[model samples]
Target: MSEPGKYVLAKPIGEAEIGRLDLQHRMWLTQHHGLYSAPISKSSKQRVVDIGCGTGIWAIAFATEHPDSHVLGLDITLPQPNSAPANCSFAVADAEGDWSFATEPFDLIYGRMLINSIRNWPRYLKRCLQHLKPGGWLELSDVAHRFFAEDGCSEAESPMLRWWRVVFQESSRNNGIDIDDTYKHAQQMRDAGFADVRERVFKWPVGSARASTQEEKVIGDLQYQNLQVLIGGVTETAVQHGDLPGMTAQQAQILADEAKRDVVENSDRHGYYMHFATYVGQAPR
Candidate 1:
């Protein structure tokens, strides 16, 4: 269980993790070839809301891009720039609670990488539906926790994978949430009375060895750093929740070190990749 006054994510809100999240925002942009997969370009005034908007990077960028749009970013911890764009604003709010701040319906509602944070996804979607205008769009981006290998390198059998499996499973169990809930996003949106639902999936390489193109290498490198930052938090969460039986903090650190070594050395050359999914739905007009 998460301690009081702390968000659902296991990691501490420090410079290192905040920096990782900024890089992750860049990675998502590179992966999608833009700020968002949904069609958000509009010449007229539009109201946009970003739920669980860490760092407010995406909100700022979108506000900068669409000057006519007013973008509101909401999160538990609003670590935003001192001087944001004229059209952008941020607030400290919990996504799980009632969103009474939204006085009017939003034209675009966005969320990213919130799978682990959200407890009741169906209710969340229903709330999103209520806050969206008749023709408004809601988009969510999330990644699967499970690892995959294209080649028969057996890296999936590695201790790193084992650690992630246990940590994510136990974390979800303890929090009463589904860490891999994005797989059901489309159905959930439909159940919430959304229309024109669409889903996109991307493969994110784990290491640079499998990256043939320059873009792939960049994504791979960023992903490698992402994993490096995640291991510690995963282990910490596992220890806090007593997920990994008999695993000490020192032992967890050792495992994290070994996992980093394996990735850096490319010892297995497993061509491992993770699945990133984007789901978009529109409210009935």
Candidate 2:
């Protein structure tokens, strides 16, 4: 019932959008400061594993940054740029299945945005802990579904919100996964026997930062556009196939058109924020 590896079926927004995948990857790594605190750390002392590694973008970058560390990017598909660093490699594997290839404990475990595929958080956390060496670090991040209004920027309730929520809830139910509460990821880490846990939240504004000062406005705008396409395409397909109820063709079209207008107009008065939360913890020594 679950399409395990299908992340997004949306069209690419631009080269910038293409590039942001790497940016997001890097931002995620930077946010997990504990894992990279040792600037001169040896790679041989650290083995890094990225679960649901996707295109291996993060894995490749990590390998390039830390040549001493062997990085393994494991996912269901091994598609990636052929020119990856020698220290970085990929393997086709399922996170829900046994991972015999990684009997040796790793120094770091990284996972991001794989919420929809993981049906059991406890099991997933246990697996992550088992493969992590004592005192190793686990850094995980996920996005909250609600795109919100940061104070002073108000928006009338848009159909996009309703439509996207329905699609996510329905799709997750159909896929045997409950929608994840990424905000509580720290709790999961603690339950998994992790120590020194920390969580940080990053908010991305919808358009030009005429308001929010902490983030790059243009990058956020482009990311907002890309997100519309991502969520819209999935919701449209699901609604068309009757996976979601109460969404008429006309409503779907209206929501899709509104989403496009939101990005194109870059409306400042109606500000919304995309929420990204990251959790980091160290395994018990």
Give the per-residue lDDT of model 1 (tens digit) for 142-205.
8876676676555365656655666656666677766567678888999999997888776788
Lowest summed lDDT across 10 adjacent residues in model 2 is found at 1-10
For model 2, residues 136-200, the per-residue Cα lDDT tens digits are: 87877777666665544333554445544656566557767655567667788788788877766
Give residue 161's error in model 1 in angstroms. Answer: 1.6
CA lDDT, candidate 2, residue 246:
68
TM-score for candidate 1, residues paired by index: 0.85
Off by over 4 Å in 2: 1-44, 151-156, 263-267
Q: lDDT of each structure?
A: 0.74, 0.66
Superposition error at 284 for model 1 (Å): 0.7
Residue clash pairs of candidate 2: 43-68, 43-69
Task: Please give the distance, in angstroms, between residue 267's alpha carbon in candidate 2 and its true position after superposition.
Answer: 4.5
Clashing pairs in 1: none
TM-score of 2: 0.80
